[model samples]
Target: MAKITYIEHDGTRHEVEAENGLTVMEAAIRNMVPGIDADCGGACACATCHVYVDEAWLEKTGERASMEESMLDFASDVQDNSRLSCQIKVSDALDGLVVRLPEQQG
Candidate 1:
């Protein structure tokens, strides 16, 4: 299991255990974290699962695929660390990883 920290808009941190091989969005949705709408489920179609991962954790989180990169253009407040949580597979390597939730979604 991996420990993921979800940072809220008000700077609150919520920690939860994430199962390996699960998507970040799946973990968030399963844990009932706020801001991860996942309206399209785990599919790459919707950017509603957008999240900003901590830059320091980027290397461990791995790079985004072209599909994720292309979709981020539609994500609000896209940044260098922005990623679709649905496209990210969790692993023990992701333990202690932290992702910030965006304020809004379209």
Candidate 2:
């Protein structure tokens, strides 16, 4: 499992352990992390699960897919580090992934 940290816009933090095959979005939703609405339930069809991947962990999380990029265009406060959590798969390499939520989802 990987330990993922989800920090809300207000600085609230929720650290969760996610199984290898789960998406970061799944871990947040399963652990009840307040800022990740995950409205489309990991389908990459909405931007509610948008997050800013910690710069330190960006390489491990990998690049956003074309579909994810399209979806991110609909999110609020898009950034160079912005990503759709559902597009990031959990793995041993991402053991300490950290993501920050926006003030509000799109």
Candidate 3:
């Protein structure tokens, strides 16, 4: 399992063990991490699961696909490291991955 840390807009942190192959959004849901509404499950059809990948882990998380980028246009506070949590598959390489939630989901 990979250990992932989720930080909320208010600096609250939730660290949890994520199963390999599960999407980051799934991990958040499993661990009861607040702020990830995951309105579309893992379908990547909505921006409610948006998160900002920590700069140090951005490369390992891979780049956003065109569809994800397009969906992110509806998210609030989009940033260079912004990603749809559902689009980030958890893997061994993603252990210790850190992401922050935006102040609100758009």
Q: Report clash pairs, candidate 1.
A: none
Q: How high is the lDDT of residue 1 in model 2? A: 96
Q: Any runs in candidate 2 off by more than 4 Å, and if so which?
A: none
Residue ranges of candidate 3 with Cα displaced over 4 Å: none
lDDT of 3: 0.96
**lDDT, candidate 3, at 19:** 98
lDDT of each: 0.90, 0.93, 0.96
Q: State the weakest 10-residue window (summed lDDT) of model 3.
A: 37-46
Best by lDDT: 3
| Candidate 3 lDDT by residue in tens digits, 13-49 | 9999999999999999998999999998889899999
lDDT of 1 at 58: 92
Candidate 2 C-alpha lDDT tens digits along 1-106: 9999889998988889999999999989899999889999899999999999999998888888899999999999999999999999999999988999999998
Order of quality (TM-score): 3, 2, 1
